[model samples]
Target: MNTLLKRQLLRGLLLAACLPGVAMAASIQALNYSSREVDYIAVENPGNTNSGGGGDSIRPYGQGGSICCFSVPEKWHADLKVVVVYQLSPDPTFHRETVSVPQYPDGKSGDIWLIVYEDGSVGAVVSLYGPSRPEWPGKIKGYPVPTKEYRDERRKEKIKREKAVLHSMENALDGDVSDLTPVELMRLKGAIEYSKKLINILEENDK
Candidate 1:
């Protein structure tokens, strides 16, 4: 083969090899509409961990940033399925569910959305658009709305954390601090005051 022809053939082969990887890559995003915070979400094909992706905690009524590079076929197939494994906050157990991949319209590929519902059921949809877009396929519309239960739980957790901080600060103040530099002593006193103020605010809100 001539040099130019040989170069052209080599380039064509490289393009062919690269195309499939580009086509197969996709991202996973979580939309937590549930009353509980989502601790984590992992998406994989049944018994196949190599080709999947996952993301960390998303607060109730919040959307998680995208986690990249899960495999999705360029062409949609009827038999396609992904296993979703996730956990909700305050719940020690992890849940797993097998979900069928929805068909993409017009052969379009998009990110996989894992929807966590208020009733604790999880659903998956493949969409090129996010919840803000009209093309979104999830049943609930717009951003998630936190239920009363969720709000109450959040408040309680916040108060608990603040109380712990106040207790720690109080204990430190009670200890011998004669060795602390004047600047350090002032900062410590300021932190204790801040902690007291936060605890007071949380307590008032609880009433």
Candidate 2:
């Protein structure tokens, strides 16, 4: 082959060899945000604003809120979906939630959510929330708190016997039974018998 023809052939071969690697690199980007898993983008505690805290490296949204969007690639809606979880203002007003596209008239559309928490910790309370799961978009509702019944202080006397039995059971597992102390062992035996009876009663009730 001539000099020019030889160079052209070499370039074409190199391009073909590199095409697979280029395509794989594009796929890696999608892997970072996949529909099979949930991703979290934590934000600063809105309760703490004295530091002029709202948006920063740790928090991406503004004082108002932050949003993330995902969608099905190539317009393929089946076996693939996109999820967008967002952070919204803690304010009770202004709908105080997130909503997704194709709010209605759906046949395999993406999902969206707005999660509101005082902080990004377990102890932090979740305020206003919204969802679009198994139905249309609307405020996510929660159950009301139930009242706890009062326990009299005099009942404390009865707990001592239970505590003693528990202690004996703990010691029994340590192989410290050399000092088995018949009184302690007797208490443990009685506790075990009572517990077995209670369990039987519960099983019968369940049935």
Candidate 3:
């Protein structure tokens, strides 16, 4: 799980209780269930690494081992998923460094996010600090913030989708006029004409 996915999964789970569809009872159930699940996974040194020849991770969440934060499906099922693909990270110290096993081989203390899917695809992230860990853990606060580059990329995709829709509509206008009601036909034609005129005006202004 990258930063964006981590933040999103947590934020969604945290807000699940408040979402419209899920009943308040279910939300409360799920929230409590998730908390317990998190505690279960987090132990005093889940495992240790000796690559750097140090030892297994001895840091409990607050001190003994890593906090080891991760998420489960809102339903808390053994097989519920939330994404196409996801990856859990090792430790926050490794993000900036190489992935050598023996390099700083100590358990990490941070967050993990796992988004599982019905199809078995997943997305996940693990890190040391909140920022490096892909996302924060708050709904009101910033959790699933996309990077500037990611935002720009999404904007481009939106523009492309809009253009595709416009092109399809323009093509439909030339295809059939028989099935459409009079009012519908009139609106479609007017929209097409107005768009063409707008394009012409813009071109003229540019010239």
Candidate 4:
């Protein structure tokens, strides 16, 4: 499964436990039931390829097998199972790398990242070494961080999503208000108002 879907499933499972007035006994019962239902699907490695092949940056290099990491679902920590399917290379030396995987907080995808090279040395990097963001792993003590590209990209995406939501609300509002039912109109109006509030907060934070 892809990262996003894995997160959604985990979040849903967690929400059920964190709800208000959930008694300890009730929570345990629910958790036990949920644990039995959760299962892990091994990620399929993207086929090996060369750097010159296709996947520009994020895409797996053609020469190396792709590694996708996933977190265990909440409540299933005791029964968590990890399965890896090995792909053999033409040369024995170009074999799959064995990684020491760590248990990540349930639901985060890729807490364990595998590094594969055509030369056959496989290494595993834990995101814990870095901050919550994997792209910005922990600093090298006093060494300066070369760039903030990842943070900038995150800001850009937040802006993009906000704009899209605002645009959609505006379009909905521009449609016939006369024909709109009271509930539908209220929903659209609330969305527009929420978008305005979000924009204001973002602008304030930017300043």
**How do these models rank on lDDT, best leading?**
1, 4, 3, 2
Q: How close to the true structure is residue 191 of candidate 1, measured as C-alpha lDDT?
A: 90
3 or 4: which has the higher lDDT? 4
What local distance difference test score does each model get?
0.75, 0.30, 0.32, 0.38
Judging by lDDT against the true structure, name the best candidate.
1
* Better candidate number, 1 or 4, judged by lDDT: 1
Which structure among the candidates has the greatest TM-score? 1
True-vs-predicted CA distance for residue 97, candidate 3, Å: 15
Across residues 80-136, which tens digit of lDDT does each residue of candidate 1 receive?
A: 788888898888788888988777744577887888888888888777877787767
Please give, for residues 40-103, the per-residue lDDT of candidate 2 as tens digits.
Answer: 3222213322211112111221112222211112232223212222322342222212222232
**lDDT of each residue in 17-136, candidate 4, tens digit only:** 564422111100000001011111122122422101111111122112232223323332333333232333322322333344344433233333333333333333333333334453
Report how far residue 38 has shifted in candidate 2, in Å.
27
Query: Which candidate, 2 or 4, would have the higher lDDT against the true structure?
Result: 4
TM-score of each: 0.66, 0.20, 0.30, 0.34
lDDT of 2 at 42: 25
Off by over 4 Å in 3: 1-142, 187-207
Ordered by TM-score, highest first, the candidates read 1, 4, 3, 2
Error of 1 at 30 (Å): 2.1
> Candidate 2, clashing residue pairs?
none
- Model 3: per-residue Cα lDDT over 163-204, one tens digit each: 566677788988877899999988988877766665555445
